[model samples]
Target chain A: MGRTEIIEKVNTVFRDVFDDDRLLIGEQTTAADVDGWDSLKHISLIEAVEEAFDMRFTMLEINGMKNVGEMITIIEQRVV
Target chain B: MNYTELEKNCTRSTEGFVDSCTLAVLGTGATQHLAKAVKGYAYSEGIALDVYDADYNQIDAQVLDPNSELCHKSPEFTLFWLCTEKLYEEFCQSKQRSDFADTVIQRVERYWNLVNGKFRTNILQCNFLQLDDRVFGNYGNKTADSFIFQLRKLNCLLMEKCLAHRNVFLIDFCYLQEKYGIDALRDSRMYYVAKLPICTRMLPEAAKQVVDVIKAVRGKIKKCVILDLDNTLWGGVIGDDGIENIQIGELGIGHAFTEFQMWLKELGKRGILLAVCSKNEEAAAREPFEKHPEMVLRMEDFAMFVANWEDKASNINYIQRTLNIGMDSMVFLDDNPFERSLVKSMIPEITVPDLPQDPSQYLEYIKGLNLFETASYSEADRERTRQYQEEAGRAAQQCQFSDYGEYLKSLEMTAKTEAFDSFHFSRIAQLTQRSNQFNLRTVRYTEQEIAQLAGDERHLTRYFTLSDKFGDYGLISVAVLDKQEDKTLFISEWLMSCRVLKRGMEEFIMDELIRTARDNGFDTVVGEYLPTAKNKMVADLYSRMGMQPAGGGRFTVQVKDYAMHQTYIRRQ
Candidate 1:
């Protein structure tokens, strides 16, 4: 999967986790961009992405990503 | 199912909402996720649950403050999920463990009294979760004075206190911990970082349980379990494998089927109507139940049994018609995926749970679904199955009669009507909450409110229980006549169980009401027919029962001209 494909898939997850279908996730989309994306639900979003991608995110990878674009790049490398 | 799915679903806006309810959550720790999950799950269940989440660890301020959001919300259901850290703090401050337990109980009592006095919502108090004790370790249970022991005692005491209050309900989180495991339910990292005691992963599961309570309180509970015979009940097809060959005994693989049957039997005892819908020769399908010595359920246990080569969905339709219950109140269980899917597609309202491939997991899966969550249990509930079975017999006998009037008269039905007493209070309140179709006015009330009405001299509260030659229909009807107006008796609430419909019981109760009005020297007895989506069947009850339409869904009968419109029911 390329970064675009990963971003496409991850956007669905973002929309689903945040419960907003119209949510458009791009390079600049951060936790602050979405409603109900608090620290408590951050872990659940990561877990859902892991389940969707059929891979596990390291604690470092989970904590290190600052934006949706960085998360997509990490998932791109993992999927490949 | 999981927290993410629940959260996502909660965010989606719902249309065509039915049975809207308000719920407030006051937690000692983080509970916003739980509130979201609850809204999502409740929406999926067709309940538009508006949840109010209080500030973390500020239950006292939220519950006690009159100007707080909780006061403004005044939700119909209030859930309190408190962790043991605060209790532990109290324990450490106290000199003795017993003193700690006593003080905790006192605090809960004070808070509950304060909350109940201020608001009218039902309080769902969760028991303390045993988050491991290192003080006494394994010996904590052996010592009554230990923290763990005291906590257990405190939970029991909380249950006792909750039972004493009609509005307070203790939700057993300890049982949830046992089912899902303590570690899975509680996340230490989330607790430290976000103050979330219950893990985000298990928030959906917890919220599902809370919604179950809300569903029961709102009287949206499943009443029947429609089972599929053959592999669903036993290990194999009874026709292919003979009664003796079917796995349903104490030996090896049979134990799982036997345990499942035992659980179904227990459910039947608790008043959940059991029926069988299978595709086979009726005689062949029933032979195992008739002849098998190891069978835990007998033919008498089932209220309706349909066995034929017809499609299972059609048979379920037939069963629903015979039982006179809504499709939503029935749960169909079948081992075959095709049969389950067919029923699901045809009768979407009926609950058709996905049966696991393994038969042993059936018991745990059903228990986890909480399919039959009941708000109140009484002696009447225990007699529910027997009454339905008798109803089936009556239905069978009705087919032989030429006319419905002759059939009702032949049954020798009689009813004993009395004021709402302690014995019938819970059942009356439950019936008022749950009864929809035949309810003239669909007004729901709690047990405490019913008790007050029963005691008030101005209100003439009557609960009717019918018994024919077949059996007793335990506490089937309730009528509250308010005499607050001058020389007028107002029928504030009147509802009856759908099981006892079309039996002349309505006429019999009307006669009793007329007699009461004459005895009390009232000039006019007023009644109403409140129209709701579910209660359209009884929209014209007042007009049909010979009452003049006084406008605004109201009707009145003059006491001097009140003719006893009776057919069969003999009052006792």
Candidate 2:
């Protein structure tokens, strides 16, 4: 999936996870941007990524997931 | 990073989340461990949730108040059901059935109905129904009878409603109460304030009953009925009692054993694999099954046999291996709890149902399980009994032939693939859910999704049913085909029942799929896999089939790369 397509997908997952339909994700968005996006749900965000893309992520990459930018970079590498 | 960027990056990952997922309910304490576990499940399985502590103070108010905030906010999944034994106690202990029974019953009924009405959504209610302190006190026989009747009816009604949801999981606290007496619910860790608690840690005895139910949800009940020997089937020990002394058909205990064995035979005759694991002398065990005219189960009836003196687990393992299937695929039964415990400790996967105390309770135990859950059976499944008998016949005859190749030639096996139709639909559905060891992707699907895929032009689902002179292993394998722009055929789901694995039926299906892809103007055939624990046996299936791994176990072979010259070879 392209960056734009991936962004839309991420936004949908974010809304679902945060239980707030209005929640939208962007390149610079961080965990602090959304309420209830705590350590409990951080793993769900990662899992949703793998299922949506049919891909796998290592612990090293997932642990450093500070912002959407870093996560997208890794996903880009995987798709290619 | 922005959410968009995170989604973009994460979307392209080539691996799935963490390893195993264990749903840990955070009791009032241990919130930290529970949070970490939920995070782990989410990270691993994509979604993990914990109790939000709704109805913390006023459960009745939260439930009964029509304009309550929670009543309006429809939850995605109702996390916890507040089955407050304390609440029930408070209401009942008020010295007034007239004061709250009508209102309490109404609200409780509505709360249960709301949760169970939706399938795929679960309400993890702490099933704290009990006769704990005041209720278990002296009551007239009539009053106690009515109380038990109403409570049991409510439980049955709640369970029936919960069954509607495919994902509805009953974390059985009721079973816990059965194992551990109700007073254990008073443990401080499990119960504090208004909470009446029972847990695996506090109530160690009730652990298995609760843990087993959760673990079993990993797959459907794969094994049907576990056939027992001696007192369970034949009324007496064959070795000690002798064949003539064994009860088969007569008065008293003979009739009970006969009826139970016949019921088990019927279960096996209907696609449920039947096997025996008895700790009796060989002739003594064989005599009743083989020569006794009144016996319900015969020698040729059972699919796998183990009458040796080894641990039941070891013998069961041998039977499972010889049959080439998972241990979870068999249910082991014995008259002795020692043997039962041995197998339970050794093979945690097999379902070891508790043998009833009385001999008459045997049939009730078997019927209570509801093992046969399949709504539909294919043409092939109807002939399962005869097919198993034939497989046994083949097994016996193959002993005479030394060479595996010669034995293979004698069977004259045919390799033909049938396109997806109503005929093979349910069987294909079963293979996906039932098959474990031989599955690569091991993708489970609902019947609706399967129907759409089968009807679509872009996908072709096919099942391979193998047969020879012995008998037909009906629709024992399934493969879902996907089409790419350049006529590339992608293997979405591929699995074979382990019973049919050694017969080269996998290669046969692959050859046919490759041919179908070629005829459809496809250039290459690809094998795709999604990881699962029970399906590790097929991790190298694609590479072993001579297809080059395109990447991460995705093997794509060109039509020119395909070869069909191989003769079907199976070990005798």
Q: Model 2: what TM-score?
A: 0.57
CAPRI rating of model 1: acceptable
Q: Pick the candidate with the highest TM-score.
A: 1
User: Docking category for candidate 2?
Assistant: incorrect
TM of each candidate vs. truth: 0.92, 0.57
Best by DockQ: 1
Residue B506 CA displacement from its true place in model 1, Å: 0.8
Point out where model 1 deviates above 4 Å: A1-15, A19-80, B396-407
DockQ of each: 0.41, 0.01
Q: Rate the local accuracy (lDDT) of all candidates.
A: 0.84, 0.61
10 residues in a row with least lDDT, candidate 2 chain B? B26-35
What fraction of correct interface contacts does each candidate retain? 0.50, 0.00
Predicted candidate 1 versus true structure: per-residue lDDT over B1-572, tens digit per residue: 77877766776677788678999998887788788889988877778888888878788898789988998888898888878866776677777665667778888888788888788888888899886576888998888668888888888889888888898777878888999898878866556656677877777788878888888887888989999987788998888988878888999888999999999999998879899999999999999888889999999898888999999999999999888887889999999999999999999899999989899999999898889998887787778777878887897899999999999999998889898998778888889877988888788888877888989998999989888999888788899999956689999888888888889888888888888888988989999888887889888887888899999899998988877886688878
